[model samples]
Target: SIGNVLLLHDLVQAIPGEVVRWALLSAHYRQPLDWNQSLLDQSRKALDRLYGALHRAAGVETNGDEPPEDFLKAIEDDINTPGAMATLFALSSEIERAMTAGDHGVVARAKGELVAAGALLGVLQSNPAEWLEGEVSDALRIEVEGLLEQRALARASKDWPEADRIRDRLNALDVVVMDGPQGATWRVRT
Candidate 1:
């Protein structure tokens, strides 16, 4: 009989299914997984970082590029998931560099490769916007949106104090607002 087993239902109840899946795949298949809260937390953060990258590259159009050769080799070599995951983050770093250099073509290619690699690992399949949004309630989302709108208006009107106040309010609600060339985008603080 199984002893001290953690049920999938219990895990999914505590965190996102994708996060649980990520944690499960973090180790080699041949290795015994030392399941714990720390592993789950780390998995959640790692996924968040990946999703955040995709979110930043959302405007770029993917060019249908394949996953990098290194990533493919890692997966093919004894199903090295950890190595593949490392390659995905490397692709994410490439995306960041491309974005910083304003090279949309490279960003598009890297983003596509990252997504394809993630598909092989059964992760990062969720829409970046939706994944980053997590399980926030509709009411909370509406409230955050309203506050963001108000902050935008304040900034447009050069009302620095009002804008600061609105930003502070958002911080209190665990919402982080980022001002980009397009406008302000908000995400829940992890």
Candidate 2:
């Protein structure tokens, strides 16, 4: 229990719980952590990708599927969390493939298995939706949209420097601008 009378008055700077969890989970227990905000940010993004795969698998039916045997074996061997994490990524890739194939049963079962396995590893404590939505501001979105438009105009006029400048500004704000054949899209830096 925190019994310090001045605790509230001197509340420490807070980092989000999810970020901290991911950051800690990023390294093995025996390894020293060079704790930093950037590490946490990267961890949060990694968690986002993991949950995004899960989100995509939502609404699929499961047929009593189980986590990969190898993953389970790795953890059972010696609490080899890093090994488990690697296995999780591999499983996620399989889930992604199943989702792409529209195999609802496989998708559902894969997700269920993943969640169960994650529980054993102290991960995936939050709902996929929480990480999926993220914490971007409406104002930031509007500003990014405007900047994207400016970038487009700059590119259209063969203003390479101007386009690059706009892109750099977006990067500064942690907005990832992806250009595809269909069009350009911006995502919050993950």
Candidate 3:
């Protein structure tokens, strides 16, 4: 065997499920693949960019910018992963530009194309919000919630400075707290 399955388990054990998928997805099928921690790390970064672009595209209307056909061409040529991934990188740039310009039609088309292309390659990380949040630990979540509660208490007691300080601290962690008539809720900052 090239590498024992049990031995490979250690290599993948520490990685997130999606990361394993990304690591494999990025590699050409017949080529000798180097399985390692760094590949998984790089996979996370690449997915972050691709998924981040999709999230950005979600808000804008499709601008009628059709998906480039090259990705499909590459796939048809016996699964040219490198070529397809390269094409996706370029498409990600296009999606970013369309989102920046608020071009609804182009954004919509680009997103669809991106998703379709990713789907063919089995690397479509659809839940960009969860992915982009970068795995918030439970302890961090609890701590953020605690600060939010403290902020609420400070506001009720008319301690504006304390409330503001709590908010600033949350801001530093990229946690966005929203105060509503019902209560306060928080989300990881985008």
lDDT of 1 by residue, 1-190 (tens): 6687878988789788889989998999999999999998899989988987888889999978588899999889998989999998998889878877889999988998999888877899999888877779999999998998998899999999999999999999998776765577778887
How many steric clashes does model 2 contain? Answer: 0
Q: Predictions ranked by TM-score, top down?
A: 1, 3, 2
When summed lDDT is taken over every stretch of 10 residues in candidate 3, the lowest stretch is 58-67
- 1-190 in candidate 2: lDDT tens per residue? 5753523223223545656666777777778878766887787777776776766665665456466787788778676677888888877887888877777777777787887777776677776744554568889878988998998999989999999999999999987775633346656765
lDDT of 3 at 153: 96
- The order of the candidates by lDDT, greatest first, is 1, 3, 2
Compared to the true structure, candidate 3 yields what TM-score?
0.66
Root-mean-square deviation (CA) per prediction: 2.1, 6.4, 6.6
Stretches off by above 4 angstroms in model 2 are 1-14, 62-66, 136-190
Question: Using lDDT as the measure, which candidate wins?
Answer: 1
Provide TM-scores for the models: 0.90, 0.62, 0.66
